[model samples]
Structures are given as C-alpha cells and as structure tokens.
Target: MKTCRFILSSGLMLFAAAGFSQSDSTGLPGDDFSLQGALALFKRSSSVEEFEKLLNTESSNVNNLDLNNDGQTDYVKVIDKFEGGVHAFILQVPVAENENQDIAVIELEKNGNESAHLQIIGDEDIYGEEVIVEPDGDDAGTAMMMPSSGARYDHGPAAWLTRANTIVVNVWTWPVVRFVYSPSYVVWVSPWHWTRRPVWWRPWRPVSWNVWRPRRAVYARHYVVVKQRRVVGARQVYRPMRSTSAIVRTRYSASVGRYRATRTSTTIQGKNGRKVKVTKTKVRRRR
Candidate 1:
C-alpha cells in the first residue's frame, strides 16, 4: 500500500509540472500580453467577447476602475486560465467625466485548478495625470496621463500603462509644433522681379532694382516678432513671426547747394527742383 501511494503521488507531480510547462509555452492562451499590447487589444476589440477571442483568454473579473474616486469607470479586464492572472486595461469608449460604470467583464475562469480576480478600488479620474502602480502578483495594470498644464496643444501619446501593475509603463504627449514649425524667412519681393526670375529663385531674391541703375539698390531684412492671437479652446497667446522688416528705401537725388540743417537731421532731401540742400555748418570768426 505504501509503495502504491508513493507511485501515485509521483505521477501527480509529473502531470502538474507538464501542465505548467505547456501553459507557459502556450502563454495562457488569453492572458499572455505585454501591457501595451493589452491596451492596444482593448482599443481594437469592440466587446469583451471579441477581446477574449482576440487575446485567446477570458477575464476572471471585470468591474469599474474607479477604485476610490467617485466617477464612471472606464476600464475592463481579461484573465489567463492556468495561473489565474489578470490584465487590467482601459476602453476607448467616450464616457462622462467621473462616470465609472461603462466597464464589463468578458470572461471568468474559476476552477480549483486556477483562479484570478480584478477589482476597481477608485474612480478613473486618476488618469487625468499619469499614474504608476505596482502589479499584484501575476496581474498587470495600465493608465493614461493627460498633457501637462499650459501644453501647447493636444498632440501626443493618447494613452499609457504598465504591462503589470508592478512594471513601469510610460506614455508621452508630444507637442503638435514638434511636428510642424511655421514657415520661416518670408521675403517681400517686387512682383516684377519675381516674374522675371525662375520660380525657384524668387524666394531667395525678394527685392530687385533696375540693372541699368547700379547705384539704385534694393535689399530686404528679415526678423521675427511675437504677436497675440486666440486659438480654439484657448485664450490670447503669443505667436512667433517668421519675418518682419521695412521693405523699401526712399531715394533722393541732390545737386550741390548750401542749407541750414539741424545736426540731428541725417536725411538729406532735395529742395527747389534744381538743387538739393546738403547741410554743412561753418564756424564764425569773432573779431
């Protein structure tokens, strides 16, 4: 009898080990997912049932994610069979702020053999900012963080979370301007000059003077200035300009003539159609 009992015990141990090895190889059929992979799966799958089929697993428990905060829950879960592991993730469905009841459980595997459970302790509001948490045993968790205060715009990672609550997952919100900088170096060229030059070169040569008069020159300076403007859902904001400057210079032709002019007056203008007053001062001899 003792010998028979030993044999039976040994046989059971082998069977259990084999089963565990098989489970590892197949990856729980449904519970095997990287944290990001699980969130991606949730976004793509329409329903809990669809999610399970896609993930090749079921949920041990699905409930609101508002673990403590009072709000509508926007999270769900899927579980693996052999070890009873849980994967907590969020759904993409739009919900009222603070409402936490949109979540649902897709599958449950509870056998003496393997069992897992997931619970939401608070509201999903924790997602307003990035949140990090440690995983529970074999379970994983994920959450999303909003863009920082005074963020330039709403262009960045839409969501983020960890593979397991214990594992750290990071999501970044990239600035929209990062992808696009306003066109710089605006040149105000004469329409006549632009038409005469090749289309490609027009941007480089903004102003031109008649080639016949080499002394008559035309040039432009480029500089940027900040201006205020309102954007959708935002208050007045400062925007950068690509270029700003005086485009043209006034010209004056002068013939020699004496004129009283102030020291501060640097600009010389032609007077009396025939001659221009080029100002010069003379010292008087006191006798």
Candidate 2:
C-alpha cells in the first residue's frame, strides 16, 4: 500500500500568511532569492543539468541572488543527494573561494512506483525561517475565502486547522521528478563553479527590492507555505548536509535590523487566545 504522510513539529503555530505581501513587508535579504521562482523553473526543466543552466541563465530572470554582495548575480549550482526513496536537490551558490551557501533544497520522496511528494524549503539563514512551499492541490481552491491585498486567499479546509494543513501533491506527475526516481537515474552534481562557468551564462547586477518583489509575486502565487515536513525521510538525509553561509547570515542580519527599525506594529496572542494587534509606541526613557 502506498501511503503519504506529513509529520508536524510542535511549536508556536502561525497561520499561513499570503506570500510576501504583508503591509509591514520591508523586504529581507531572502527576498532576492525566490523559492517559488525556483520551483516554477524546476517544473519546466527536463533534467537536473538543464535546471542548473536555467537557474544561472541571464535571461531566465528566475535567479536574482547575490549572496556575496558582489556586483554580479551568483551562479546557482544543483547537487542531488538521495537515500532509498528520498531525494534532496540542494541549490547552492559559490560565495567565496572555499565557501558555498545553500539557498534552498528541493525534497522528494517516492511512496510507490507512481507516487511521490515534493517540497522546497528555503534555508533559515537566508529566509529568516523554515519556509516550505509546495504545489497547490485542486482542493486548495475550496479553502475558506479571505480578503488579502485586494485578492481572495484560501486557507485549505481541514477538520482542525493547525499551523499548516496537509495536502496531497503527487509530484510523480512532474517529468523531472519521475526521472529522478527511475532506476537508471544518475545523481547530478554541477561541475560549473565560480571561475568555471558556461559561456552562455552572464551574471547581472542585483535589482532593488522594490523592483524584484513584483517579479517574485508572479511565481509566489503558484505555491503555498506548508509548515509540516511531509517528506520525513528526505528531511533526515538533508539535516546532516544542510549548511548556512556566514556571509549570507551577516547580510541577512543587517537587512533584518533595517526592517525592524521601520516596523509599525506586531501581532501577539491575547489572554483570551485571540490574536491582538499591538501598535508601536515610542516610550521616552527616564533620564
């Protein structure tokens, strides 16, 4: 019997917010790299090698990450790691001579010959949290209607809504995903590095947050944030190899600091268990 399950972790549960469209969104370093965009590109790619080229292609417009703060956009390399039925495609960038930063991971777990589940997780150091995005199921359309930024948003229907509701996304239907699960599949590790890259590739300067946000939204609308780790096997295999770049972390911290300085309000849980919106107030400190 083929079975798919998502194991939820215990913590402070947060309702799924519309993708990066909050009023208080001042943007972070993570904004430059879009997991939604990556997933969209991945779907179009036929193989891992082609996916790597698409990621670094100048005209693709899917990648805008400049993790090293260099004048040019970073070349994203793909590395596939697999164990049993789980495969983790680590999307990484060479930030320094001897250092590489993992931007996000495309995780897939095969439940049967024709059944698989997939999700992409953004690295916390870059994204400020464990952001998981997967394809929107047909039933996702039936989620409760709520107004968000002038558009209707749906929080999928479940008996009990928690931080993230489970949905079945059979990635086996995706060509590249199914190819990776085949017996003849070979693990793909990108050969192109900082000094050695494809002649067709040309890096461009990173754009301002304001300009990139809209481009990102185009891809973001196709995905949904799910907090639960459905592919447990893939998660376990990736944890040991998962890495964060110190350089990216430093830049992320600076971006966060700047964002906090201009933030107006924050949400907190009230005594009655409902969410309370608390406005920011400047309290003059006594001399």
Enumerate clash totals for all models, in the order shown.
31, 0
lDDT of 1 by residue, 89-134 (tens): 3322222233222121212111111112122111112221111222
Q: RMSD to the native, candidate 1?
A: 37.9
lDDT of 2 by residue, 148-196 (tens): 3454323222211223334455555667886787779899988877688
What's the C-alpha lDDT at position 30 in model 2? 65
Q: Model 1 residue 282 lDDT?
A: 48
**Decoy 2 TM-score against native:** 0.71
Every model's TM-score: 0.16, 0.71
Model 1 lDDT-worst window of ten: 247-256
C-alpha lDDT of candidate 2 relative to the true structure: 0.70
Distance from true location, Cα of 267 in model 2, Å = 16
Task: Go through the candidates in order and give the C-alpha RMSD of each one to the true structure.
Answer: 37.9, 15.6
112 Cα displacement, candidate 2 (Å): 1.6
Local accuracy by lDDT, each model: 0.24, 0.70
